[model samples]
Target chain A: MLLVAPAALYVLVFQIVPVVYGLILSFTEYTPLQRGAPTFVGLQNYAALVGDADFRGALWVTARYTLQVLPVTIAIALVLALLANRSFRGVGIFRSALYVPHIVSLTAVSMIWLWMYSQNGLINDILGTFNLSPQHWLNEPSSALNGVSVMRIWKALGSNMVLLLAGLQTIPKNLYEAASIDGAGRWHLFRHVTLPGLRPMLIYVIATDIIYLSQSFAEIFVLTSGGPLRSTTTVNYLIYTEAFEYSNMGSASAMAFVLFAFIAALTLIALRGGRER
Target chain B: MDRNERHTVYPANRRTFLKTSTAVLGSSLLVSACGGPSGGGSGADGDLTVWWPGVNPTEQDFVTEVLIPAFTEKTGRGAQATFIDWPDMSTRLNAGFSSGTGPDVYGHGPAAVADLVQYGRVEPLDDNLDQLDESDRKDLQTGLESGLVDDVHYLYPIASTGRQVAYNAEHFTDAGLDPDTPPTTFVSLREAAEQLAVHKSGKLQRAGIVFSAEAVGMQQAFTSILWAHGGEMFSEDGTSVLFTSDEGVEALTWYASLYQGDAPVDDNLGGTWDGLPPAQSPLATGDTSMTFTDPATLKQIMDAAPELDLRFMDVLAFDEGDEPAAFGGAATGLMINPDSQMQDDAWEFLKLTGSKDYNSMYAQEVGIVPVRASAIDTDYVKASPAMASAVANSEAFRSNPNIPAWTKIRDTLAQYLEQALNGQGTPKEALDAAAAEIEPILAEGR
Candidate 1:
């Protein structure tokens, strides 16, 4: 009761209710503002979704972003964790320094990164030293998504590094010693003992990445706002645009459901693939 | 880890219960001590709440120098002003209106007013509106009648604003074009733009115009071209969309031709529909030569870049087709919530803010053009070198069709127009698609 009841109540009050209400709204021509009221028609919004070119485009962008950010953030975090796991003189200090960003606010991180990505910002300032011309890092439609992905990668690294640290610590030293006695090389030792030990943690990390990537709103909201053009319009951002800005709550909910199905399918496939590996 | 070792039962359980009951008794006693009112009930009923969203410093100056003092002197009602961004305002307002609370009087865009009125959230100003002096009120331009929903005025059109071509005079002369004579025809406008444009290296240095037709801003821009070519968004009866007409197609073609590839129809992807990452745009840096702007936005630009050296031109006349029409909208005005508790007091504060002296003061501080023709500074309009032509041409401005669902239609039009500009669809296809989507929405209200 203690474990499930509190979370269940919380989900019921905020998440489940809103999702149910939103799903119910998907078939109706529900615009809260202007003239007219909601009138439900079964499968209408779904039919519209099926035909929407913009929705397809958004799905493509979301898949591309998730693929780009997920592996990159994971690889970088693993590298950081490996480096900080060593017993150097300032190893403890380095570990804390690596963990600092995990505790820092997202708004602060996004703001700092936004400044860093600006034309006259840190990256541009460095490029200028080599006599290269400054580029609008977050301005061009092509680079805006990449720029946001880089910031997310930086943010994702901290938390993943912490998880990796826990995974690294749990791997028995006796296993490494046994591998060493068997004349296993450093690569073989790591492959045999460390990799297998970290598999569970890897699965947990991958699941987290799936959930986080699907709901990547803040960085997009603070950064390019799906812009230069609709080049960066993710499914969630697209849903928000339809609901709040256009007042097409009905269509927005339909879009939301479509996004949910997509992410859910991808997550299931990912978990199955991880298990197979 | 043993159960016996883990016993750390709290001693404060009984004490906490006793203290909580005592605190409740103490709180009741405290309430009794404070005596007969809803504990610190709003400092005074004399204080009024007004909502406006614009340049904060300018709004602050207006409140400090004009509205507050004038209201206090006339009726002794102190005003509490709140600022909200125009885009996020609808959400906040809807939330507030749903709950019967906050702010006695507020201001919003004319179209937003229509939506709010439908919800029965705002109070009708017919009583005080009728009380406005007949002669003084007549001077309020008829274009302000756009605030009317169902033939009943839901908003007070406090000030007038319109779009005009803002250009750098220094560049105009250097480009071998006469500063006095701006473009009057579509061909000449293109020629002028070509002359004014400056590029260096691979980077685009300066452009003649930004083709993006934002909702409030560039509405005049793209629409003016359409108007000059004998196209409009709606028919006179407000029943049909006229965007796909031959004139509109020609206008779209002309606009798209300026850019070699991927014209900047809307850098934010129709602004509201798709939010963009926060970064400095070329327009923000004054990288464009001639751009359309309303007076208040122009004033804001000048404030942001005081070194801005620019000239203003009104909407141009067509060669032989249609009359010129600039886009216009209101700044802000006092609106009472019908659901407000203090109805009579709110009305009194509204009257104070709307008084000729107080209102005019409000206008000057906020950099708004006077809505009432009587208040258009006779000396300033005649002599102010910069604003004289604008003042003269202000009379020719027109409002976009006041259909309530026009926001959706307008955004949809922008998207299709963007597609047409990029050669994805013909101008006619774009317009026809928009009309097909919008026709039902317009018919819904009727």
Candidate 2:
């Protein structure tokens, strides 16, 4: 009890307390610049968001981003895991090379992607070689989110691959040998033995990806700044604008809770679907 | 390993982990709750701290090398100077002001004055103004006017920024337009731009001119035109949106016209003002013939491409008959924290920044326009043709409204402006939408 006390208290004071305080703040009209204490305007902040076009647009954008990034990342990650799982020459080097981007700071990664997506960047230079016109990658509203999704998928692939690889190792080799003896093909063995065994890891990956993708902010900030006409504005980015840029803390807190609820709901649905599968 | 074997190795279930964590947390809270806050006081420490948003390495070097040393020598008091980037300055200042921990003195753009005043974080400069001599007062009058909130000045003017229509002289000569004389009206400007433009296939290889849609919602590029047409962003009371009026709509329509004509620009495809480094700017790279630029940008262009022939002229007018208008004022000024305990020392240091000698040196070394009228006429200010024209155009300078909600209002307008430019909506519809969005924000403030 004494050994655990310090660690538990730190989480309670720092993490849990701030979350509860943020919840209370959503019920008030809070501006840090205002001299007086926050005026309680219960449900007013949430009600205003219902009529706010920007808030609705941000919610749609966040959902679109999640749909675009989550599945693609998992799919690519699974393929990489399968490739890396085999006993091949210099496989350790291959695994380490794949994991390099994951170790780099997200901000640095975003900046590198920002440069790559520039009009005259390496991406366009390669496209030019194919006699294709350079596309406005981050500047235009239509393709900005797609550009960010590509970068995000690339960044997330490593972690998902590692997790899936661990799950792959956990599957007993006896099952594969037994299937081979029964005259079952690779497809049949994988369908019956491998997938069921990987169900728990798949659920964890899908649920966590949904949560993180819905909370996207840094990429949008570095790339589009929610512009070329707010096409990349996610709910989290909008919350930052409301709180820091506009100093509307109450409204920002309300938006945060809405996002939290959204992520929680999606995560629950994903887990339930995974279980059913 | 099998599930039963794994369970034997790891006995801690989720339920047990939660129970143990709760027990530990409950006991820990009781022990830690007895402690109190570690710091004291609502005022500043004896030593003074000054913050200035640094533009470049030279600016930072000037502050650390020249300003701090001079202040320490003159006042015999220890002082520290911090150079923050422009984008991060507001966030840092807001946090500092909210927590009563802001620097004793700091410099910021005029647009931030209203927020500082509203938060009661700045000290009024009435006493400082009263102490100044007649000539000193007269010289600072225009610059100081921007710092006033209900006739009480909260900032001491140090430097100002004014916009100019900067053109590539080589491009002008190539297009058969006179290099010495630049366009002074909208029609002539576009005509000149058309002649200078180069299109390759469906893409613009080089634009004739560019209207930058960069920071502060493209106001730096559009405000001069808006003012030329006698448009204001807000009403006198700062309680209502006014840029949705007839003048504003016409100005925006004319501004958007440049995007599709012979002088066609595609800001969406990325151009001069894409927040790239100065070396990659359209003007520097010969991608644009003309742009509405400031002194800092002019300096950057000169630094990046020394061989390029550049010329500066006053911002274009609505018509030949209309007077040239530019967005200018004390763009950056120094203000004292209201809660500063070392108020007198901070004031003494701040006064040095506003002095004519200091400003003249600042203009010479740092390439910023001095706020003091006396300093504006110096040889250094005159040598830079752009700064000289900016000074000449200072009389017509108009600024954004000083209101707490101005940042929000500006952002809203920028979004709609982009929509109109992108053909998503008509200029009237865009402005109307902006008005609709801003009205509620303004009303909330009221």
Candidate 3:
């Protein structure tokens, strides 16, 4: 028990205390600027959330953003993992190059993406070579979310590929040999052997991706600022604005808890699906 | 091991657990206290700490290299200044206040003053103003008035800001318009914009004029237009939303029309060019012939592209005879933390910043409009046309209501204004929706 005390104390101080305090705050009307203790207004903040149009819109945007980015990112990442898994010359370099985006700070990556999506940016410049018109990637509501999603997919691919690559290495080479002897084709081998083996890592990747993607703030803030009419305002962005911009900490905390509940439910569903498979 | 066997091996008991928990908790608290901001508690005397809102390299250098040294030299006391980016200012300040680590002196826009005042977080500056001589007080009267909340001075304004239409002289001449006389009203401005607009294959090649279309910028642009049309954002008492008035709808209609018509004068919606490096500005890049921008940006553009004859029009009205107005005033200013042991020191620092010499030096170095009216005679203002125009029209500048909930209300309205600009709804509908959302916030603030 004495040996376990340090880790326990760290969690108690850093994690548990903050979560409990946040939970307590969700029931009160608090602004850090105000002197004295937070005023207890139990359930009022949560109740207000139900009728908040902006909050509701943000929830939808968050869900859409997650759903839009996850499957595409996973698919591309898996393909990259498979390619990198092969024993080829410079494969190490290829893997490293692919992982660069993941290691880069999200803010830095977002800044680059912001420029790349601008009217005279690299992406449009390339399109101009094909005699295509310049596109307002981050300006229009129709294309803004997709523009962010593409950057996210690119950013998330590296980390997901690395995880899948690690999972691929753990699979027995004998399984592939046996599948080949059994006359299994490449697709059949992947479906029957590689997939089952990689399911655990895939589950981990998807669950973590959902959590991260659903809470995206920095990119949205730097790129579009949840604009062209709140088309990209995620719940996290709204919660941030509520808490810091407006200093309505109680309502912001309520939004956070609601978001937490959503993330929990989605994660549970992913876990249950993984288990079923 | 089974649960009972494990318990027996550990010999755990309630008393033992309680003692262990207490020790850990006590130590954690001690560590936390030690790790917190140094000299943070109220009445802890030391050198003054200031958090200036803005990370402009020039401003940062001026504060560090010039201002701090001056303060220390004059007072025989040390000072620390932290340059915070504008967007992060409120968040950091909130965190500091909550943690009892707020600086002795901090700067934010006047919009935040009311909220700080409401919470008793800031000290009233009326007494401080009384210490100044009549000439100094009168010189800063306009800026000082802007920082008032319920007739009480809260922030000591360091600079003034105004948004004016910056036009290209060559574009005007090329469009068969006189470069000497600029548009005085929104009506004539739009007409000029139409003539100046360049289109290729039904696409805007060069915008005639660009108003900031991003969320925050849109609100400012709309506020400028609303004020020009003689519309107020709220009633005098600030209890009710007045932006839903017919004049507001008309102002928004004209503003939205710029991006809506077949021959749209502006193309970039939900994108901002306000704070971009001078070379990349729409006017500098020739992407737009005219744009609504502040004095600092305009001056930078002139310096960056001297060959391009850039001129700023005075604040515009809706009609030739009406009072011209623009969304600006008290861009950023300092407030004293009431709990600071160094309130006198903080005020001294603020006085130095607000002094005529420092004010003029700051304007010259930072390219911000000086808060003092006397700065007009300064060589910097006389030499720069943009600075001269801003100073001359200081009375035309208006700002968002200084209410506790103004930021939230502004953002709420900005979202709807964006919707309107993007054709999600008519201007009237957007204003109605915004007014509906804002009314409650306004009432709560009151």
Per-candidate TM-score against the hidden true structure:
0.79, 0.90, 0.95
Best by lDDT: 3
Highest DockQ: which candidate? 3
**Model 1, residue B351: displacement in angstroms?**
4.6
Segments in model 3 whose C-alpha atoms lie over 4 Å from true places: B7-15, B18-45, B274-276
| lDDT by residue (tens digit), candidate 3, A1-277 | 6777788778877887677678878988988787666788999999999998888999999999999999999999999999999999999999999999999999889988887787777999999999998898988888999999999999999999999999999999999999999999999999999999999999999999999998999998888888778899999999988998999988999999999999999899999999999
For residue B197, model 1's alpha carbon misses the true position, in angstroms, by 1.9
Clashes in predicted model 2? 0
User: In lDDT terms, how accurate is model 2?
Assistant: 0.78
Q: Candidate 2 at A268: error in angstroms?
A: 1.1
lDDT of 3 by residue, B39-135 (tens): 2424555778999999989999999999999999998878888989898999998888877788899999988988988888889988878888999
- Tens digits of lDDT, candidate 1, B157-252: 666666676676777888898888877766676778777776656445577665443333334466777876667878766788787788777877
RMSD of each: 7.9, 4.9, 2.6
Q: What is the lDDT of residue B318 in candidate 1?
A: 45
What lDDT tens digits, residue by residue, belong to model 2 across residues A98-153?
Answer: 88888988778988887777666789889989988777787777788899999999
Candidate 3 clashing pairs? Answer: none
Alpha carbon lDDT of residue A240, candidate 1?
73
TM-score of chain A of each: 0.92, 0.97, 0.99
Q: Rate the local accuracy (lDDT) of all candidates.
A: 0.66, 0.78, 0.87
